[model samples]
Target: MTAAQRGRRVLVLERANKVGKKILMSGGGRCNFTNHFVSAENFISANEHFCKAALSRYSQWDFIAMVERYGIPYEERKHSQLFCLSSAKDILNMLLDECSDAGVEIRSHCELTSVSALDHDNSRYQLKGHQNQTPLQLACQSLVVASGGLSIPTLGGSGIGYDIATQFGLAVTKKQAGLVPFMFSDASKALCERLSGLAVEVEVSCNNTLFRENLLFTHRGMSGPVMLQISNYWNPGDTLSINLLPDTDIIQWLQELKQQQPRSLLRSGINQKLSKSLTSELQALWWPEEADKPLAEFSDRRLSEIAQKLAAWQLKPSGTEGYRTAEVTRGGVDTAAISSKTMETKHQPGLYFIGEILDVTGWLGGFNFQWAWSSGYSAGLNV
Candidate 1:
């Protein structure tokens, strides 16, 4: 749409049967289009400054203005995440409408077999592909690879973008799953399974990075905003330090409670801070021998031990859920070879890499979508 708006004929070849399949399924069908707050700090990249230029040029406010122009109703959720009020289809329709107005053509189910430079100057390019099982070929002045990363295969995620980057002699970084849930194989797995469907607001930390959000217990592992956010920095064998009661100093609170209610059971006092089921599980795991002990019966040293557990519960995950359920891929084409200002490849003229296909990965909110809009707009202006 941006390219077409610039008076350049634009053709979008989609490998899936439809365009924007990921958009349709994002944010529980009501797509989180962008965030109220976005900065380069919200993204992780080999080149930390690579996204700054494009993002500054086409910020979230720019996209919001377009959404408002279309009169699309939206609402801001937790962490300034902006989501469509009705459905994600509204955003898709708006883009499609823009494409229509700009005379952009979209061809679905077209898979590119190969791409090559047509001249020594590399000013022209040749693309060979099959559109819906029929052989198709085209020549163009510019080729923009917006193919997304490998996260959800059912959503049409593929590595073709990375493959193209490598084919062009651009360095590709090691890829891994980001914004994914942690799967445990030890006793933690049983605990999570037993507490499946429970959601608790907590601060989960890994590798010195902390995220204060809701942690959800799943039958297979743990998920929700907190786990997904911290997963970006977590690696295998790294133990996660979870603060079940982050806002309160557990030791101080417990000591005061013991003085005020000397006869109250420890579980009863702790239960006020967490779910009874969760408290029970913690009691069994951390202080099974003192389950029946009252506050007064527990020594200060023992109370401190329990307080430490509540303040910093440790859990080591065997691994993540992998790309099967990850929200995004962690790495891709190295940003060193891509022009941050125009998103065009420095080594390969007329070739641009944008969105998840690059080494940039945003935080769990709407940062990723903002990158897509910004990078796409930057490339569109120059492509």
Candidate 2:
């Protein structure tokens, strides 16, 4: 749409039956299109500064203005995440409306099988593909690869963008699942299964990165905003430190409760903040002997130990759920070989890479969508 708006003839070839499948499914069907506040700090990239230029040029406000121009109702959630008030289809319809107005042609189920330079200076290119079984060929001067990354194959995610980058001699980085759920195989797995469907607000930390959000217990593992956010910083064999009671100092609160309510059981006091089932599980794991004992019956040292355990419970995860459930891919084409300002490959003139196909992954929320808008706009102006 941006390219067409800039008076450049644009043709969008989509391998899926329709365009914006991911957009239609994001944010529980109400697309979290962009954030209220976005900076380079919100993204993870091999070159930390690679996304700054494009983001600055086409910020979140620019996208918001477009949303408002279409009169799409939106609402802001926690952490400044902006989501469509009705359905994700609204955003998709707005984009399609813009494309239609700009005279952009979209061809669905057209896969590009191969591409080659047509001239010595690489000014022109030949693209060969099949549009639903029929052979197709095209020639163009500028090519933009927005094929996206490998995450949720059902949503049209593919590695064709990375393959094209490597085919052109551009370095491709190691890719992994980001913003994915963690699966446990140890005793924690049983605990999680037993407590499946339970959600608690907590601060989960790994590799010195902390995220304070809701942690949800699943039959297979743990998920929700906190786990997904910290998974980006976690690696194999890393232990996660979870603070069940992050808003309150457990030690002081417990001590005061012990003095004020001598007959109250430890489980009873903890049950006030945590669910009864979770508190029971913790009591069995941390202090089985004090399950039926009153607060005054326990010594201060024992209470402190329980407090420490509650403050920092250690749990190691077997691994993530992988690309099957990941929100984004961690790495892709190395940003070192790409121009940050225009999103055009330095070594391959007229070839531009944007969005998740690059080594830029944003934090959970609407950061990733913002990168798509900014990078797409950058390449649109130059392509």
Candidate 3:
């Protein structure tokens, strides 16, 4: 039987709102559709190789083709991030249109009340929901859970994915908000507040993983591309080291500064690269007593210490801004329970999970959306 003749009823459960709520708010309104370089190494999950199958099946080029087919103009930003020339609505329309063409029924404004499979007919599954005062029951041979993760609750992201996984004897990894802003220490918060709206190209590191991008100081804490990327690896009480001068070797550069202006004050010399307020903060931290002293008077050891401080300034974050401000959730349904090729539950047949519902979390740039399309498409094809 053909797909239509098979009468294969498929139900996709979306919360009362809509998909692409987060997409609309991402990248300053223009959605970063996908990234050029999407490797398994960039993703984080319990089973490392699990992402390889779906990613290979639906490559970045594949997503770009679909975007191009829709006549949506896109441009490559830094780090090969593809963004729509118009708005994020184009991408949403593409996904909805694909579902329509495939005869997949999407039920919005309907919350999933419960889901269970028939004990006798293992291939049969039932989904319960409500449209208004009347209840709705959807029965199908295949059931896919694409409810997403609990990141931005305002956008309708929920923990329903894990809850459903647990109902079916699936394991859920420890979940936390990823790609979020870092909340600073009291001292650091004050300093960040002083430097609010200041952004510089620098490197941010956490747990040995380094992100080279722009770090923006916000009124509440730290954000921007670099900080958001590194936020995945960061934990409370962990120090986030910042390399203010990532390209220029501070040690060698300081030596050059010594040769060029031997009698200049340390703060005056650093003023060339760092902001005046930031320079003052560093001077206060480095040389509170002799902050006004000339660079020529400093010994090699003191200069080395100062250079090291500038090269890698460490700050312990109090916590993250949490789901309210996070771009994605870090962990979810463990990958080991699902087949990498089809996203079907290994323990339970005819059951599938996709999108942010899985543990796999991508980097800041368009990678997560790529995972969504890839994993969603994988299950869509098989289901």
- Report lDDT per candidate: 0.93, 0.93, 0.85
User: Could you list the CA RMSD of all candidates, in the order they appear?
Assistant: 1.1, 1.3, 2.2
Flag regions of model 1 displaced more than 4 Å.
120-123
Instruction: Give the residue spans of candidate 2 off by over 4 A.
Output: 120-123
- TM-score of candidate 3 relative to the true fold: 0.95
**Local accuracy of candidate 1 as per-residue lDDT tens digits, 1-383:** 89999899888989999999889998999999999999999999988999999999999999999999999999999999999999999999999999999999999989899998878443478899899879999888899999999999888889899888989999999899999999999999999999999999999998878899999999999999999999989888999999999999899999999999999999999888899999999999988988888889989999999999998999999999999999999989999999899999997889999999999999988999999999999999998
lDDT, residue 56, candidate 3: 94
Worst 10 residues of 1 by lDDT: 116-125
Which segments of model 3 are wrong by more than 4 Å? Answer: 1-7, 120-123
Worst 10 residues of 3 by lDDT: 1-10
Error of 1 at 219 (Å): 0.1
Give the distance in Å from residue 83's predicted Cα in candidate 2 to where it truly belongs. Answer: 0.7
Q: Report how far off residue 222 is in candidate 1 (Å).
A: 0.3
Candidate 3: which pairs clash? none
Any residue pairs clashing in model 2, and if so which? none
Largest TM-score belongs to which candidate? Answer: 1
Residue-wise C-alpha lDDT for candidate 2, range 157-227, written one tens digit per residue: 99999989988999998898999999999999999999999999999998878999999999999999999
